[model samples]
Target: MKEITFYLDFVSPYAWLAFERLPQALEGLSYHLRYRPVLLGALLKQHTNPGPAGIAPKRAWTYRHVSWLGHSLGVGLDMPARHPFPPLPLLRLALECSGDGFVNRFVAGTILRHVWQGGADALDPARLDALRAALADQLRQDEDAPERAKRLLRENTEAAAAGGVFGVPAFEVEGRLFWGLDSLPMLRACLDGDAWFDQHWERAASVPQGLGG
Candidate 1:
């Protein structure tokens, strides 16, 4: 059996789409999933990346591309009332759902739908209250739950960056990182036991980087 760690932030539309598309994408393959909600902003800052949403034109393009991806992939996705909203609450909520650092597919999907299905404010107080209610059964409301969730999210983010994960919707399989929603096909190929990975995948990263000093 194989395991894949799914790293995502609730603030990412691509993450939302990938979460819904994953099972179908990897159909017929048996694998375990670890849902890890990380801080995308922290990852971006570490890599000196502004992310797609940081630039005006790219943000527009990202919005259009993700919307098209949703329709083509048959997943529900709608822009929140805003882009780049704070994802801390949502991330904490998700961890609280499992009372651990990881979430199962069902819990992940439920939280994702709450964000991607409605075009309203994803972080609106009322909406979050409702979301909490929906997951009450799974949520751990102990005095330590909030701090534990925060610590776990921080640890997850640090682990992701140290492991070469620079973006969301990233899947880690047997120590290899496949990033972005667009990489689903490649991920499936890897899972299918393709020979190309053994022959050429890691070699791609070993190529010399040339920088004019």
Candidate 2:
């Protein structure tokens, strides 16, 4: 079975939607999924992007769109009490359980749900303490876990950016990237061995580009 690495950031509502819908989207597939948490800010910085939330109008549109998308797709998603909250705490918390930087599906899903399920404050200190306690039994954490998790997050984010990942909720398989919550169908088509990919895959980058048109 081919391995598909799912690169995600807790800061993205779309990532939560993709994570929720993936099981149904790829049911009966012979692929192994690896959940990876990365810093979305770092990913955007590597690509020189201001991010969707950096713009005023687009931020509003994105929140509205993601809420609708999740609703339409049968996955519940609600904006947290704040937008663009610092994800460092959550990201590090998730990484603490990932020795090889590949988080367990259950762990990643639970964290995603913690952020997306309710319209509460994701950065609330008390909530974070509760979440940390909840996962304590599942993890054999060390006293220096915080520092280690921070280092691991940096390494993972750097590697992801080097691998051409510029955003959250990106699926990487067969060296091809399928991004966005809406790209699940396209990903499935490729995984299903569609003939169209065999014919046109290379043309995406091989096609001639017109300069200064």
Best by TM-score: 1
Q: Considering only N, C-alpha and C atoms within 3 Å, which residue pairs clash in candidate 1?
A: none
The digit string of per-residue lDDT tens for model 2 on 161-196 reads 898998989999989998898899999989999998
What would the per-residue lDDT of candidate 1 be over residues 19-81, giving only the tens digit for each residue?
888888999999988898899999999989999988999998999999998898888788888
**TM-score of candidate 2 on Cα atoms, chains taken together:** 0.95
The number of clashing residue pairs in model 1 is 0
What is the RMSD, in Å, between candidate 1 and the native fold over all Cα? 1.1
| Clashing pairs counted in every model | 0, 0
Tell me the deviation in Å of residue 171 in model 1: 0.3
> Each candidate's lDDT (Cα)?
0.88, 0.89
Error of 1 at 62 (Å): 0.5
What is the lDDT, from 0 to 100, of the residue 77 in candidate 2?
A: 90
